[model samples]
Target: MSRMSTPAESLTRPDGSPIRVLVVDDEQTLADLLASALRYEGWEVTTAGTGRAAVRLAQELTPDVIVLDIMLPDFDGMEVMHRIHGHQPNVPVLFLTAKDAVEDRVAGLTAGGDDYVTKPFSLEEVVARLRALLRRSGASAEKPANVLEVGDLRMDEDSHEVWRGEDEIHLTATEFELLRYLMRNPRRVLSKPQILDRVWNYDFGGQANIVELYISYLRRKIDKGREPMIHTMRGVGYVLKPAVAQ
Candidate 1:
């Protein structure tokens, strides 16, 4: 099960730097999950577990956007936002509130928050919200090409078209997604579990064999009759790299 596809246009700062984000939440697990999701979008993410930490990190990072939880161990998120806004007045904030806490949601927005998400939100929702906030803040004005390339292989993410050297290769949706993941992290070995979570959106459980199946499928289409770009490491995992011409 593939995760939700990101926006077609990759967002970056005017100077082409990764978008900076600050995530503040007392729940360590939730904070880590949000940070992972944001980093997957190619943004820089910093996490803080308390209001004081949030304020301090905000000042240090001067982040482009913030995801703040309303309840914190130290002084509450409102106070943290106030202190951060004192120095970074123009930074956008997206608040996290409990699903039943309507008052907290209203207060957060009234207190200058730019957006809010209830608890138990999906990672995709948070990522989408943060992207919208970044766009609205005018912090990310550069839209990088929606293409991935390694050596002579090219993939148009928006068009979902693939090419190997001069030959256009047709791929199924799953094959395209698998190839996209490999192309995104060229030369980096990806374990079966990682591929399952990212591409299949599930735990390993007993499904490791599926990764091998897909790798074989991709190889026949992408590597057959050409210099091989996908390679397996015994007892490790798999990697995709540029083919070395003989």
Candidate 2:
């Protein structure tokens, strides 16, 4: 199953600019993953692998929020937060800690960290936490709605409900996830590997067939008796777009 999902609402700064985010983690892969996830929400993201770099970037960007790893090469996240607070006092900080680091969690919160997520956490969880922090800090202007639509098809992410025009549609958990990913990037061709990574959370070896199988499943339910909104691009990939009126 996928660990990430589209946010219900896209948030921006009060000036309608992308919400600036600073992601600080010594683990390059994790940092890049987090940065990608945040950017998908239409936020501007910058990453730093050291506490010193984090402090410097925070000063340069004045990010609306920070995702700081508790462990860093130069210094701990606490010191980075302290250094940054010296300048941008109100910027929200979300700490990343080890799963078993109870002391670190306590210490981080006590040291004025806005929130914390343990390692092995989902991208969705981190995004949700950051959104909450942004709202609490008055740093976000949210465009409201949990529903995603393309053509006459609509999905309510919060309610787990889907509809084709006035008719409701039912889907299995995997099918729902696959459709959600397609809906999220309407009209963009999604390669089999991209679909697998986003919906299944990992590569299925070279078995890109799983993506094809699920795409077929979604097509049967979503386009069986209606104008087809899901299309295949030969060897390229799949795309979802508004159905042309007959």
Quick one: best TM-score, which candidate?
2
In angstroms, how far off is 62's CA in candidate 1?
Answer: 0.7
Model 1 bad stretches (over 4 Å): 1-7, 142-246
Report model 1's TM-score to 2 decimal places: 0.55
lDDT per prediction? 0.79, 0.81
Residue-level lDDT for 113 in candidate 1: 72
Return the clash pairs for model 1, or none. Answer: 1-200
Per-residue lDDT tens digits for candidate 1, residues 47-88, read 999998888898888899999998888788889989998898
> Over the full model, what C-alpha lDDT does candidate 1 score relative to the true structure?
0.79
Model 2, position 135, has a per-residue lDDT of: 62
What digit string (tens of lDDT, one per residue) describes model 2 on residues 82-108? Answer: 999888876778889884645555567
- Residue pairs clashing in model 2 are none
After superposition, the stretches of candidate 2 with alpha carbons farther than 4 Å from their true spots are 1-3, 143-246
